[model samples]
Each structure stands twice: as C-alpha cells, then as structure tokens.
Target: MNFHPSHPLQAFWNLAAAPIQAMALEQALEHRLFTLLAQPATAASVAQQLGLNAASTAVWLDLLWSMDLLVRHVPAGKAEPGYAASPLAARFFVDASPENCAQSWQYRARSLARFAMQWCTLLREGFEPDGRTKEGAAASTGSWAQAAREQIGQEQRVVTAPAVLHLMDALPPLPRQGRFLDLGGGPGHVAIALARRLPGWRGTVCDQSETAEVAQDNIRAAGLSDSLEAMGRDLSHEAIGGGCDLIWCSSVLHFLHDPQAALSKMFEALKPGGLLLLAHAELADDPVLAARVMPFYAGVMLRGNHLPQPGEVAGMMARAGFAGIHALGRIDFPMAPVWVHMGRRP
Candidate 1:
C-alpha cells in the first residue's frame, strides 16, 4: 500500500501502512538496532550478537534500509553485505545521540496510539473521547497537562532554543535589557536562550501549573535563576504580565479555547512599540508532506486544537490593534516547518 498521496485508492490504503511504519521504527528503537548498526555488520552477525534469528534479522535490516533507516554495503570478496545506520538514524534514532528523539517516539507509540483507535468514534461522535461531559473535560485537561510535562523535554530538544534564537536573529533588532514574556512557553528554554543572547534581559515563562513545574526545573538546571523564571498561570484565562519589550508565544494560540481573547490580552500586555512573536505550524502550505508523516499532529487537531493559517493570525493581530503585522512562513524547525507571525503594538 502506497503511503504517498499520489493516488486516491493508495491514499486510503496508507491508513494501514502509516502505523505499520511507525511500529517498525519504534520496535527497532526498542531493540537498539540503530546503536548496533553504528558500524556496519552482517545481519547474521547482528542477530547472533543480539540473540535473534539470523533470517528475521536480515529481513528487518533490509526493510529498514529500504525505509532509509539503514545503509547496506557489500564488501569486495565477501559473500554477505553489512548494514549500517543511516545518517538520519544515527542522528535521531540512536539512543546515545544528543539529538536522539527515541523518547518522543516511545511516548507516541505508547500514549498516542490509543487515540488512533478512536478515530472512527471521534468522527461519528463529533467529540473527543475525553471531551464528552464536564467531568470528561476535566479529566482530558489533566491528561493533556500531564502529557505536556512528559513531552516537554522532547519538544524542547527537537524545536530547540537555538532554532528560536535563529528566528529572532532574522527579525529586526531586539532591545537590550528587554522585559520579555514567553507565553505558554514550556521549559523556558527559548526564553533562557534569548535572555542569554540579549545581555541583562529578563523573561518569564508562563504556562499551566504542572507545565510550570517542568519549566522551573529546566530553569534551575540552566542556572538562569537570575534572569529566567517560570509562572504557573493559564494564558487562556489569565493576562500575561505587562511591560514587556518582546513577547513570544510559541505553539500556543491554537490550543486555547479562545484565541482571539488571548491575542487581545497579549496586545494589552505589550508595551507601546513592543514586538509580539507568534510561532506555530501551518500545515496547509504543504498538505501532501503533512499527510504523509504528520499523522500524530492530525490527531492533535482532532482534539479541538488547531493550527491557524497565517492569514487568519494576521487578521487577529489587526483586530487586536497590532500594527506592522507580517509573517514568515515555513521556518524550518528540526521536525517540521513553523509559521511565525510578528506584530508590533501601536
């Protein structure tokens, strides 16, 4: 079955194939295949060392190699070829790499796989599995918050503070000693990075109570106590503290129950001429690519969260009394492209 959206019938068939691909990769991760394949070795050798069947190991290696997770080399005068981890696997699949995302994949495999089972029910019921009644909503909220904490490390590593810093560098100059607020910022990584770049700058990371705890730990670990702080506040219902020269809201608005209200609050929270940077994913720009590999995010959208179009966000900024509004679409993060909406309070 073709996972590519090139054919209509194949598209439907892909529904079955996508999860199979994810499961294969996750199973490989569990077996530490990538680590073993850091140096090229015959599949039989791998199987013998890992205590597995040689035939099955060879077939698995060939499958992963076809999927670009491995590379095979046939040595001259040797009867068997050796398999090695691909660059992608070495970088992201290996458990010991600094950029390893095995934990994130593991989380998805364990936690999100449950949601996939309810796709038909979600479509038929027109409500999330955990979003039926008030009690259900509360439970779902708690689950989401806990998920946020669990995924923060992975998210922080993937999206990266350096990436945010790069985005800031492309923009107009930021003020020195700026008062900044990282609204909905999990782990305060971006704020700490930005604060370091702009000397004497202090920023606060505001998020849900549980998420704030995670951010606090990150802040302490970074030794940024003097400049970065985490506040436990719900941005959807609460106003971010005022007097900020710059306010960064990353991957946040779409999840709020009322994005317009939050945007309005952000406008009020910013000082005159202060900049507000809204960073989020915009999948419509490349639907084919998104459909191919971003199935997990599709589930996220199904759960009442959203990824607003750039035009929609610009209109919201205009309505909120923000001027000089503009957007930089398709800012490449490690995992996906993010659209950035920048506006200045008049």
Candidate 2:
C-alpha cells in the first residue's frame, strides 16, 4: 500500500466543521425531497418514481415529515400510509404549482450550503455583490436575482408582505418628516404600507429597472404615487441618496454579495442620528439556526445572496458604523431563529 504524506491537522480540522456537515446533508435531503414532493405523488408513488422500496420510501417520507416538508396520511381503517407535500415543498418544488416558490429560490437553495465560501474572498478583495454572473460584466450572467425576478413574477407571494408589515408595525415609529428609502422594494408593498401609515413621510422605491417598474406599478395601485418615487438603480455601485432620513432595506440585504458594504452605504445615506431598519429573514442573525430548517429557505438567499451568521446582524451593523444597533423580534423559520436589526447612524 502506498502511503501519502499529510500536511497539517488544520486540513482535518477543516473537514470536521459541524455547520458544514449539517448544511450539506440539509441540501441533499432538500433536493431529493423537494423534487419528489413536487411530483404530488404518494410516499409509495414517490418511491416508485425514485426506484426505492416501500420501506425506504417511508423513511424518506418520515424525514420530510420530521422536517415539516411532507405530510403522511393513513386513511381511517386503511393499511396504506399516503403522503402529501408540505406547503413549504409545494410552494417552491412543483414547477406548475400556482404557489411555485422554485422560481423565487428553488434553484438557488442548493448553491448556498455549498458554494458560499466564495464570500470570504469578497471580503478580502473588497468587492460589492452586484447580483452579476461570472460572465465578466459583459452579457451579465446571473443566477439568483434574475431567477428570483422571474419567479417573483410567476409565484404568488401573498403572506410575506403582510408578514413584513407585521414585523414593521412592531417597531418604534419613524421620526416625523423623515424620508424613508425602500431599497429593493419588491412591488412597493412595504413602502406603500409605510407611506399609508405615516402621511408625513416620503419614500423612494429603489431597485433594478424592472423591479422598480413593478414597485412603480404598486405605488400607482396604492394611489400613493405622489408620495413615492421609483428609481431604477444599482445599490452595489453608487451610494443611496443621503437626503433620506430613514432607510429601509427589506428582504433585499441577503442577496447582496457584500452585505456589510451595503449596510455601510445605508449608513452613509442617513442623516446624523438617522435610522436604518433592516427587515429581512434574519438568517444572518441566527448562525446555529442554519442547521435546522433555514437551509431550505436560505437556499434561496444562499444561491442569490450570502447568508452571514444569523446572529451576526449586530456585528454587521457595528462594522457599518452603526450605533445602538438593536436586533429584535425573533421569529421561527422552521426551527431556526430569525431577527430584525435596527440601527442608528451616529
């Protein structure tokens, strides 16, 4: 037998990280279960589709059930244990499902728990996350943003906006006469909601051209066009306008390549003592939560955006020159903990 020389224990150390192992298993199971569940097949049917025995089928179904991605049904007095896909699975797995979440994030999920190590290089190199592809700024190859945009157009994202507003209402009131900037304001619902709540406030719905158009349409629909402006712009490039007194980046930060830099930009955009409200999944706020259910949801952020330590929201705010950063209102994404970070620019 040939013996190979080993370098350092650090190599072995690298292989033994728990988070790495958990993330890997999570994605593999997700892909397997997501694809299977989307088929709208029973456990036995799925087993047939995947060429597995009924015993093995029940095991997979049990795993998905434990993960809350599947439901098992044994009709009264029946011997067969039927299975149905969970909402989480159906929302994004079944391509034809009206609630197909796959477009928004299904394709992107697996890429996270695997390829996100590239983010470390970004920090060392001081680059911005432009939602661009490796096509080298020419044809503009991208996977997440474009994919999410396409999917956002396709799927019905009904509960999320209200959920966001629900989170927002739980926060302290914005200062009077404050201009609120809604970065990547999807469909302008949050911004419209904010404007409606605070008649003294004005908003700019900032995002890419197409997304901004959708935001504009939403603003028009809300009859708050006069109070809001939709501007198509690249956040990773220029700094957001400084005229805004309050900045709100909701559900957009995770997709960023350099979330800290973006936070820094928001820090720069605010007036003295201004507030920056980050309304997102709070994935970065719960590092350990990644081991649980978020990998399913985070697969979207990971494929599209880098999910920092879920609990790193405070550290990120501090790095961005934010003072008095407060992360509050922890919620449940599966079993993982999520938080919203609110900070003030000193």
Candidate 3:
C-alpha cells in the first residue's frame, strides 16, 4: 500500500501564524516604518534613524521584504542592500501618499482584533439584544457619526469614491439633470463625488441625523451645498423621498432589521424607469472567496443582522417589482469584494 500524507496542514499552520504577520504590519505602521522606507536605506541606517537594534531591524526589514511590502535593492557602490517601500506600500501605507489609508487601516485592524476576541463567547452564548432601545439608538448613532467624521471618509476618498466612479462609467448614462439619492451615505464623500461627476444633477444623502450633519459639513466644504443636501432619517422606518431618478446604496442593507422592507421602500422612492445600483458583499459559493468576506461581517451576523448569500439580493429586488435586474460583477472594495446589482423601477 502506498502511503500518502493526507492534505498537508500548512494552510492551518499559516492560519495560526496569520496574527503574527498582522502584528508585524501593525508595529511597522505604528513606527512609521514604511514612511521611513519611502527611500531605500540599509537596515543599519534604518536602525540608527529609528533607534532600533541593528540586528533585529535587519530581520524585521527582511520579513517586510518577504511580505512584499518593502523592496530590497543595492545602491551604487554599496555592499549592503537597502530596503524601500514597495509600490503598494508607497501608494497606501506611506503618510505622504495622497491616497494614504494607514490610519483607517489601523482603525479597522484594531476593531476586527477586538471583534475576534468576542467570537468564542459569542458562539457559546449568542449576542444579547440591547434592551435599552433609546440608549442603543443614541450609542449607535454616535458611533456611526464618529466613523463618518473620521474613518469612513478616508475609506471613501481612498477606495470607495474611485470604485463608484469606475462602476458608474460602465453603466448606461443617466440624464444630465435628475434627482439622485445616496442611501446610507456616510460623510457624503460618495455623494460629493457623484455630485461633481454630474454637475447638473441634484443629490441627497440619507443617513442618521448626526452622520447627516457630518455629510452636510462635507457638502458645504466641497462647495456643493447648492446642489447637494443631506437628509437625516431612519431609513429602516422613515420615509425616503420619492421621485428619485437614481439611487446608489452600498453596504447598507445588512445593518437594517428588515432589508426586504428597505428594498421595497427604495423601489417606491424611485421614479418609473429609474436606476438603482446596490453594492454589497454577499457570502460567496467558493470557500476562499467566502472566507475573504465572512470575517469582516461576522460581527454583524452575530449581532442578528443578515448577510446575504449570492443571488439573494437579486431575488429580493425581483420580488420588489424591479425590472431589468442584473448582476454587475464584483468590485474589489477596501476589505472585501462587493457585488454590484442593478435594477430598474418599471
């Protein structure tokens, strides 16, 4: 009998070691290591500048190089190779980069790390619903408002705004002058982008009151106060104004207690033949792809929110009486791949 080692456990081992890699990157980010490596420098030089142990710094730099976050190159007349930020790191991790997302990245990393610690307890005894409804609402609003003020804007400017623009370019052109609605638009970055792209169109961003205030401030700052407005309304229960020519909603439905109802509301809000573009991450059929999505949303799921499966949102759209429903493929979002689904109100 030929003996074959069952599937190697390297994948599991890698999973076990994943936290170490994350910590390495976190430490580097905290130390502004990538910014320091914006220009190539020998590890000894890096150590001298950063006040780190030379030998340990060399090993750390090598690890980052292996991770492809840094590149090693030999400078003219130099025996020792120097490490610099890789293109990827330079674009996103370096503080001087226009599209830098290092702070937002760290915020998310810390959030997810905290969430990860709750998994065991959450699994054993499911999350308890907040009984104090008023307090919960206030807390939730404050958290979202804070995110709108800080983290969400960075993500939108760096990742989401460009993705939305690219996705819009692929679709059929809308009217030059029409009413547009951005549901759950935090800080109004997406709304601002769309407003700039369609100067003739008037836009409204709907979010929680505090968040909408943040969006309003952003709209004013962008000089779009004349054409763009933010509406503070609880979308799950309140009315979203009707006669919208286009509605752009992303990563929002899962947070609602009744997504189906929300879809119906969105359908009602649209004018006949209006377009609805919804972008959200659904649990994929492929294990690897699903793995990419699930961890980020696990807390949402544990908190009794619904994370849609593939085709699920489309089916909901169909039931909501949408016509010309179609999947627009996946957009590589900041943390995960989000499927864009389009439907027309007929």
Candidate 4:
C-alpha cells in the first residue's frame, strides 16, 4: 500500500505555528507598520520611525513581505530594498480607507492571544467558572464596557453591518414608520443602518446597561438620534419593550446561558404578526469553515456561554411560539459565514 506518512507531522507543526501568524500580524497593526509603509522605506528607516530595534523590526518586516502583505523595492543607486504596503494592504489595511479592516484584525488578534489558548484548561475545568465573566467587562472600573463598545463597532463594520444591510434589502416589503427593535444589539449599528434605509421607521437597541451607553453614542454619531435610541434591558429577566414591527437579533443568541428563555421573552415582546430575525453561525452545516473558527466561539462557550448547534436555533424558535419560520441561507461575510433564521409571531 502506498501511504504518505511523512507529512502527518507537518499538520501538527502547522497548527502549532498558527498563533504566531496572528500574533505577528497583531504586532504589525499595533505598530501601524502598514500605515507607515504607505510609502516605501527601508527597514532601518521604518524601525527608527516606530522606535523598534532595527534587527527585530527587519525580521518582522521581512516576514510580512514574505506573506505578500508588503512589497519590496530597490530604488536606483540604493543598496537596501525599501518596503511598502501591498495592493491588498493598501485597500483594506490603510486607516484612511472606508474599507479598513484593521480594527477587526486587532480585535481578533487580542482576543485570540488572550483567550484562545485556554482550550485545554477549559476542557479540564468543564468551562469557565466565573458566571459573570462577559465580554467588554474591562475592569471593576467599568472601563471594559467601553472597550466592548469599541470591539462591537469593529464587529459591526467588518461582519454584521454588511450582512444586515444585505438582508434588509432582500427582505419583503413591510410597514413604514414602524417600531423596530434591535435585541441585544451592541453599539446599535444594525439599527442605525436599518433606520437609515427606512427613513420613516424608528429604532430601539436594547442591551445591558454598559453596552446601552455605547449604543447611545453610536446612535448619536450616526446622526439618527431622533430616529433611534438605545435602552438597557436584560432579556433573561427584564422585559423588552413591546413593539409593533420588526426585531433584529444577531450574534446574541449563542452567548446567552439560556437562549430559549430569552427567545420566549422576545416572542412576548413582539406584536401579533410581528417579525423576528435570529441570526447566528450554524457549525454543523459548514464543517469546513467551522474547523477554522470553532476556537473563537469555543472560547466563549468555555466562559459559560451557550454555543448553539446547527438545528438548535430553529427548534428554539418553534418552541418559543414563532410561526411562518424560514431560513435565509448563509450570508458570506468578510469575517465568517452566518445563517439567518426568521420567524413571525402568529
């Protein structure tokens, strides 16, 4: 039998070395190397600009160059090659660009470095012990809430914003000037975007107290203060204000310890015939992509959050008294794919 046993070890090493790539990219973003390298400069000059050691800086730059994130150049009569942002980096990594993805990279890098490595400990300890440990909890001083707000902005810009906008466009006609609810909406981007689309509609983004503050700021910044507002409400206990129209909930279900109860509450919050959009990533449907991103959600699950399986969400919606349920298929996002399941109150 012809078998290739020689490369079996290669997979192990590749998996081990994956973190280094993310960490290195994070460091580069932290140093604003791509921004500085908008113009070509030798490694020595780049190092001096960033106050980094020349040798170490050169190594990092060379690594990025090898990755094709940067391009090398040799000016006429110049001995050392200069480096600059690659075409891909120029369009996506530059801070001035509307499509900048630096925030997404930075957030993921920080999260992975801080939380992704604890899988063994998580498995052994049977999940994170701290029940109150939630994302964006900066510290006892509530500083983390602000950070969470910033991270949520990044998430909206990179992932949720586009998918939501696309889905809204594809949605069937609905009443104008209706009450729209963004359940567990962080930073309120989705609501703001939708409000922008439906000029007559008013929106409310509901989240925890800290996140509500951030969402308020985001609403004001988007110049939709008159049309949109943010409110603090815990769906697990507190009531989500009654509404007469559409409700959008994205990426919030999997994080709840008891999603079914929360969905039940949401169902009550909606008016008769009101629509609810529940969006999440369904792992079993796309194992190939899940293999790459499972660790991120796994880390959340380890923190005592519930990560739903493929069909669990649909079942939950049905049990929560939702009607006319339908699937919107997978939305291809810049970060990852998400499956949207919609239901209407009968």
lDDT of each: 0.79, 0.65, 0.91, 0.80
lDDT of 4 by residue, 1-346 (tens): 8685667689789889877766777787788788899889998998898898999888888888887889998999999889999998887777887767787677667767767566577668765356545553445326535655765576676667777988887989887778889988877877888888889988899988888899899888888999999998767678887864888987777767788898888898889999999888666656687875576677666666776777788899999999999888878653557788999999
Residue ranges of candidate 2 with Cα displaced over 4 Å: 1-150, 153-157, 280-288, 292-305, 332-337
Which candidate achieves the best lDDT against the true structure? Answer: 3
Q: Arrange candidates by TM-score, highest first: which order?
A: 3, 4, 1, 2
Ranking by lDDT: 3, 4, 1, 2
Full-model lDDT, candidate 4: 0.80
| Cα lDDT tens digits for candidate 1, 28-133 | 9989999988899998999999899999888888888889999998999999999999999999878788777787667767766787787788789866445378
Best by TM-score: 3
**TM-score for each model:** 0.87, 0.56, 0.93, 0.87
RMSD of 3: 2.8
Scored by lDDT, model 2 comes in at 0.65
